[model samples]
Target: MTKSAEIETIAADWLRRREEPEWSSADQVALDQWLKLSTAHQAAYWRLEHGWRIADRIGALGPEISRPFSLAASLQTRWKRSRTAAVAAVVFALVAGSALWFHQRSDDVVATASFVTPVGGRGSIPLADGSRIELNTDTRLHTSVSKSERKVWLDQGEAYFDVAHRADEPFVVYAGTQTITVLGTKFSVRRDGDMVQVAVLEGRVRIDKDEGIERPRPAIVSRGDIALSRGEATLVTAHALGRVEDGLAWRDGRLVFDRMTIADAAAEFNRYSRIHIVIVDPVVADIRIGGSFQASNVDAFVRLLEDAYGLDVRREDSSIIISAG
Candidate 1:
C-alpha cells in the first residue's frame, strides 16, 4: 500500500478503537501523538471521522435498521476488513439506490505553478490547458498539469474555476481534506481553516474526502449544488441557480447577504479588507442583516448597521466594533 493508504488504515483503526468501551487515555495520547507527527496524519483522521459522522446521519434517517444493524455499526464492522475497501462499501450502503461514482486515480503530480493574491486583491490567470481561474481576495494555490490529468491544491481562500473540457484528463482540486473532481465545469472552492465549501455553477462534479481510501459513492454535485465539509461531517445543500450566481457576487467586488446574521456578515466582510468588524454583544451579533454592499466598503456596511439596526458603532485601532443600543 502507498504511504497515504497506510496512514488512512491507521486512522481507521484508531477511529474504530475510539468507539470501543475500553478506549482509554493511553489510546487518546497515542492518537494525539500520531496526529501531531504529520499533517497527513491529521488529515487522514479527519476524513475517517467525517465518514463516521456521515454514517451516523444515515442511521438517523432510518431508525428501523439503525437499531440492530445500524449504519454506524455496519461501518465499524466492515472497517476492520480492510481500510480502503470499507469506505466504498459503507458509502454505497448508506446512500442506497443512488448511482455510485467511484474516485479515479490520476497520474503523479508535481506542483509546477503557484499563485497568490494579496488581502483585498483579486486576480485571474489562464492555464496552459485553456482553463481560467479567478482568485478571490487573499488566495493561494498551486497547480500541476500533466498529459493525463490537471490538478490544483488550494492552500487558502477561494477561487472560481472555468475548467477546460478534456474527457481523457479530469480536473481535480484538493482543498483542505476534500477532493473535487470534474470533467469540464465552472465551480468555486473556498477553504477557510478546516472548512471547505464547493459550489458548482455548470456541469457536474464529484466530491469526497481525500483520505487515500477509495470512495465509490462521492457526493455528485451538479449545477446549483453546494457541498460543505467541516470537522467530522459533510452536508450538501441546494440552491436555485440564480441564487448560486448571486452568492458568487464576491467575484464582482460585491457581497450580497440575504437575512444573514450580523456576525456571519461581518466575517464575510472582513475577508476582503484589513479593517475587521467586531460584534461587542452576542445579541447584536445575531441581528439579521441583508442587502448588497461593496466588498471593500466596511464603513458603508457599519453605517447601515448603526442606522437601520439602531446599534452603536465604535471605531478602534484596527476594528469597527458594533454593539447593542
Candidate 2:
C-alpha cells in the first residue's frame, strides 16, 4: 500500500477504536503519539473524522438525488457548507464515485482507459505501453499508463495481465483490497468482492493487503505452486507447471475441469453464459467430473451429466437444475 493509503487506514482504525465501548487511556496515549509523529497523520485523521460525521447525513441526501443528475449541482449542493473541501472530495470518491464513473468521470481522466465485458461477454485491452490485459467473462478494468507510473484497477471479475518489463515504471494493479506490484511478469487476478486469487505464470509479483481500503488476505500461486485459500488460511503445494496452464484454459473459451465437483463445475460454467445451473441434490453435487469443454456450450455439458452419469436434468426457465434420481 502507498504511504497515503496506509495513513488513511490507520486514521480510520483509530477513529473506530476510540468509539468502541472498552477504549482505554493507553489507546488514547498511543493515538496522541501517532498524531504527533507527523502533520500528515493529523491532517488525514481529522479530515476522515469530519467525513465520518458527514457520512451520517448521507441517507438524507437521497431525496435530493432524485432530481435529474447534475454532477456540479450535487457536489456543490452537498458540500458547499462543509469546512474541509478535502473530505467532500473523499466523500464523492467513496460514496458516489460509481455514478460519476458511469456519467462524467471517464471523460475527465487523462491517459486512462476503462473497459467492461457484459454477461457472457469477453474483451481485451492493449495498452500503449506494450502491457496487455485480457478481460474474462463479465469483467471490468480501468487503466492509466504514463511514463512515470503505470496503474490499473480491476473493479470486477477476472483478468489475465501480461505486463511488459519496465523496472523504472512498475506496473501496479489494485483489485478488491489487494495491491499487486510487478516489474514485469504474467499474472492473472480474479476478484469476487473481498476474495482475490493471484496466479503467476512467469516471473514474480509482490502482493500486499491495502489495509486502509480492505482487509482480505489473498492466496498467491507461483509457477508450479498450487494453492487453495479458505478463510484466513491458505494451503500451497508444489505441482507440475503444466497443471497451472490448465487453469488458464478460459482464455481460449474452454472450461477445464480436473476432478472438480459437480457444484463447482456448474458455477464455473455459469460464468460464461446467462443460463444458470443449479445442483439441487447435495449427493449429486459431491460427485466429481473432469473434462475440457467449450465455455459457451452448456447444453453439451448437461448432456454429459445426464447421459454419462445418469443424473436427473430438468430445465426451469433460465436455470438447468440437476438432481440425483
Candidate 3:
C-alpha cells in the first residue's frame, strides 16, 4: 500500500481500538505517541474520529441491519479492504444524513449572508474561520467577514456563538444598540425588542454601544458574566457558569427554568411552538416553576403542569389555556 494509505490504515486501527471495552492508559499513551510523530497522523486520526462520532449518532437501525452491517462493522471491514474508500464512504453517508449542517456551514463562508429560523426551528451554523453559531427559535441574523474582522448582526431573538480565536481580527456581534466584541470566546446574545442580553460561557467579551454621537463606556465581561442592556445603559453581573449553561439549554432542545414564574415560562415556551400557552388566572401566572423540559414538547409541559400543580388545562385549536384548579 502507498505511504498515505498505510497511515490511514493505522489511524483506522487506532479508532477501532478506542471502541474496545478494555481501553486503558497504556493504549492512550501509545496513541498519543503515534499522534506526536507527524501532523498527517493527527489529521488522519481526527478524520476517522469525526466519522466515528457521526456513526455513533446514527445508532442502530433494525435487528438485521444492526447485526450484520452496522456502521462500525462496515467501517472496520472497509478499512481492511481500502482505507481511502472507507473514509470516502463514511464521509458520503455523513453528508447525506446531515445536508442541513453542511448547508449552514456553506452559508457562513459565503460573503455577507442572511439566516432566519422559523418560530419553532433551531439550527447551527459554521463560519469560514471555524467558528460556530447556534440559532435559537425565531432568530434572524446577518453575517459578514472581511480581512480585518468578523461581524454578525442579531436582528432579533437569540444565538449562541463559539468564536474562532484570531487576535488580529476580532469577532463582533451587534444586537440592537449594543455591540459585543471578542477575540476568541463562547458567548450568547439575545435581543428581546428593546432589551439585549449577552452572556459569556468561556473566555471574555466586551460590550459597548454601537458607533454613535456619544458611545457609552465599554464593559469588559469575562467568563460566567452576563451583560444586560436597554437603550444606552448596560449592566454587567457575575453568574455561575453552570446556571448560564442551563439558560442556554435551548441549544440542546431543552428549556430549563429555575424558580421562574409560570407567565415567564409560558412566554419562553411560546417561542418554540405554534400553540401558545396562556394563563387564564392571574394567580396561576404568578406560580413559580423550575425544571428542564423539551423545547418542542409543549404537551408534555402542559401535562406536567396539570399533574404536578393540579392546574386545569384546556386545549384549544391554536392555544392552551391554564387556570387554577
For every model shown, what is its TM-score relative to the native structure? 0.64, 0.62, 0.67
Q: lDDT tens string, model 2, 1-325?
A: 3376568767767876776668899999999999999998999888778766654454254433222112222222233232222233343333223222223233232234466676766555434345667778888777654335677899989888898887676788887667778888887888877777777788777676655644455545566664443334445655545656777888888888889999999999998888999999999999989989998899999999999889999998999999986
What candidate 1 gets wrong by more than 4 Å, as runs, is 1-111, 214-216
Residue pairs clashing, model 2: none
Predict model 2's lDDT versus the native: 0.67
The residue-level lDDT of candidate 1 at 8 comes to 66
Root-mean-square deviation (CA) per prediction: 18.5, 20.2, 13.8
Error of 2 at 11 (Å): 54
Off by over 4 Å in 3: 1-110
- Give lDDT tens digits, candidate 1, residues 1-325: 3376567667767876786678899989998999999999888778767877665554353332211111222432333333333353333232221111112235322224456777877765545455677788888877655445577899999999999888777888999888899889999999999999888899988888787755556788889988888854678887667667877998888998888999999999899889999998999888887789999889998998888989989889999988998
Residue 112 lDDT in candidate 3: 50
Per-residue lDDT over 1-325 for candidate 3, one digit per residue giving the tens place of the 0 to 100 score: 3366568668877876775668899999999999999998998788778886654443332222221111222333322333333354353333222211111233132135466777877655544355777788888887655344477889999999998888677888999888899999999999999799988899999888888826647888889988889988888888667778888999888999999999999999999899999998999999999999999899999999999989999988999999999
Q: Report the lDDT of model 3 for residue 296.
A: 86
